[model samples]
Target chain A: MKLTIIGVGLIGGSIALKLREKHFVDYIYGVDYSEQHLREAKELEIIDEASPLENAVKNSDLIIVAIPVDSAKKNLESVLALINDQQTVMDVGSTKSGIVQAANLHKNRNRFVAFHPMWGTENSGPKSAISDSFTGRAGVICDKEDSAPDALKMVEQVAEHLEMNLLYMDAESHDVHTAYISHISHITSYALANTVLEKEREEDTIFQLASSGFSSTVRLAKSHPEMWVPIFRQNKENVLDVLNEHITQLRKFKSALEKDNYEYLEELIRNANKIRGILK
Target chain B: MKLTIIGVGLIGGSIALKLREKHFVDYIYGVDYSEQHLREAKELEIIDEASPLENAVKNSDLIIVAIPVDSAKKNLESVLALINDQQTVMDVGSTKSGIVQAANLHKNRNRFVAFHPMWGTENSGPKSAISDSFTGRAGVICDKEDSAPDALKMVEQVAEHLEMNLLYMDAESHDVHTAYISHISHITSYALANTVLEKEREEDTIFQLASSGFSSTVRLAKSHPEMWVPIFRQNKENVLDVLNEHITQLRKFKSALEKDNYEYLEELIRNANKIRGILK
Candidate 1:
């Protein structure tokens, strides 16, 4: 199948690499407003060719709206206006409810499938893309009943080819669960990095004594702001809910520590340790 | 040289494996309060034999205390009572100021060298031990001037044998730096894990939908609480200082998101991205 991946950054570029490597796609056309990213994607051969959005959408069997969440809604609206019943449209945005709502009224709503593959690295841009990025990860297909049967089947086939496990859920459910499990993590990490940076102004000390635990806990703080700010804005309510809960948890811990309530602190940590069973 | 490693859990067991694998020590003796861990350590050949603490200390040329921070101080106090001038002792605890102070007036203070190898994992016990665990990691030797020259030489030799870079710092400096970098990370992770668990309340959702970002950020939450509680207690002041700063940073972020201050959020993330330069 010929596939056109718009905004070929980390997720989009990785998808292009995997599809081309597996021969699931015959020709992959890339489209991005960033001229530098487009140049890098072409130079890296992540896609077969770089083309205008209209040209790529007109010719490809599949059109992937793989951009930042805010930009994704705009692109989805434009693509829905142009795509026909035969060409499948899909998006790999982290936030889904808003995008799904934006395209809900389109006559071609049945052609678009909203998805979020639960995988990513701290790095971004086309240079950071890797082959087989989505393998062994879960791909959430949201509001699939709204999509045409053929469009859903084609997207599922691609997910299967990429070795991704398909999980079905409504767009609202996807946003809520993602806020709880994914989006909040990024915010926590970013806040943590800022915390350490602000409090420990002595960079030399952080550089000297920082261990693997610190690096792992704050790893997501290095994520691209341009990509993530929109996600937090789009999924504002769910993100806020989780954020408030996180702050409350931290306050509880602080109060216990300040009061020298070792027993309470121990119980809290012991409960947190239960996450191990689920993570494994 | 013969070596005795007390408390053959994660740190001690891993050190035993590395020392034996590199042939740094001729015979490795293990001592632990847990009979099961001692048996498992012996079965895994993490030690040549499981010996009583008294016997292990009497026969070994070098003694490594790797128990929980509180137990470490207590054991060091007892060990100091029994040590001869020729027997060199060292510790691999996360915090140092308290341990150093407890051992300061001991007659064998020169024989006791305080060291903290900046390496660990979330998992614990003999099952979690791995060979070459300290390779390429920094090992901090606190108050080296207080240790006997021969004792310092033996510890430095072991660190070099494990391919570790040795750094020298005073006990107070080590405690403060570790609190800022290591202890704070664990607390943040524990709180984050609890936050998500409290809010989501669904095990299946966290397990299935959690992205790499969440897993990485909360990975340290799986750490054994028994080991961490004492570190926090020992380094309470520094930990509290960093914790307060971390909470303040979160509040700043919350206010920014509340007011739709996208520009400030973007700038903050970009600044946090500076960590990438240092980390890499």
Candidate 2:
């Protein structure tokens, strides 16, 4: 299959790299607003060629939208405008509703499948891409029923080729679930990094002591705001709901410590330990 | 040399296991209040024998107090009371102030070293012990001037054998820094885990959407309360201070989203992105 990856950065680059490694695609056309990223993608050999978005979309069998969510919504509309009946266009944005809505009235709406491959690293760009990054991760397909059977099946086959477990959900529920599981993690991480950065002036002390639990907990603070701001903006209500709940939880922990209610604090931590069942 | 590890759980058992792997100790005495932990420690070969506290302390050349900070402060007093001039004692507690103060006026005060090794896993107990766990990590030794040259040197040598970078600071500073770097991470994680567990009642949704980022961010929430609660209690004031700052940061993020202030949210994440310099 000929694959075209728009915004060939971390997620897109990883998909290109992995799919190419497995010979799932005979050729990959890289498209990006950033010329440097396109050059790097080609130089890293993450894609076979760098092509303009229109040209890439026109020439490829599958076009993957991997830009920021807001941009992705616009680009998906653009891609749907140009794709023929045989071509499939899908997005791998974190937010789903915006993109799905953008294509709802499109003539080729059935050709577009809203996808979110649930995998990433702290790093970004083509250089950060690695082989088999999405293996064993859950790939969420939102509003699958809205898309044509063949279009959905093609994406499912690609996902299976990538070794991901397929999760079917609507766009609204996808946004809500991601707000809790994924987006809020980045928010907490940003808050955590800022918390330590604001108070702990001695960076070396933090560097020395941070490798324990702090590193893992604050790892997502290094995530690119370009990708996340659009996500948080697009899924504002869901993100706000989870963010509000997260703050409330933090306040409870704060009060527990302020009141010297070590028992209550212990209970909170013990309750939090239950995440082990869901996580590990 | 003979080694006695009191409270042979994760930290203690890991130390004993590593020392045994390095052939640094001829015999290791496992001393724990829990008989079950002692039996597990013995079976795991983290200790050469399970013995009573006094018997273990008196028979060893070096004794490591590897319990929670509150327990370590009390146990450090008991261990110091029984140790001779030639024997060296060190406590691997997260907080150093309480442990340091407990031995401040003792005749064997110079014989005890305050140590905090900056490495741990979310898992606990002797079964969780692994060789070379401390390698390439920082080992903070508080109040080196207060310890005898020989005693400090002995513990420093053990740290070197474990391949840890020895960091010397006072007890108060160590506790404050650790609260900012380590304890606050756990608090953030616990709060985050609780927030998701509260809002996302469909545990399956979280399990499906959670990937590396969420897992890493919430991994510390799986930490044992028995180990963390006492550390939080002993370092109550410092923990509260950092927890307040973390909550404040979270509130800023919440408010930014609520107000549709994406620029401020962007700035927060950008500032958080600066942690890339410190972490990676």
lDDT of 2 by residue, A155-242 (tens): 9988988899999999999998999999999999999999999999999888887766888888899998999999999988998888
Report DockQ per prediction, comma-separated. Answer: 0.78, 0.85
Each prediction's whole-model lDDT (CA):
0.88, 0.90
Output the worst ten-in-a-row residue range by lDDT, candidate 2 chain B.
Answer: B68-77
Native contacts retained, all candidates in order: 0.72, 0.90
TM-score of the A chain in candidate 1: the value is 0.98
Question: In candidate 1, how many Å is residue A7 off?
Answer: 1.1
Q: How well is each residue in A134-198 modelled by candidate 1, as lDDT tens digits?
A: 88899999999999999999999889877898899999999999998998888888888888777
| lDDT by residue (tens digit), candidate 2, B239-258 | 88888888889889888888
Model 1 accuracy (lDDT, Cα): 0.88
- Candidate 2: what lDDT? 0.90
Q: Candidate 1 regions off by >4 Å?
A: none
Q: Among all windows of ten consecutive residues in candidate 1 chain B, which has the lowest summed lDDT?
A: B271-280
Clashes of each: 0, 0
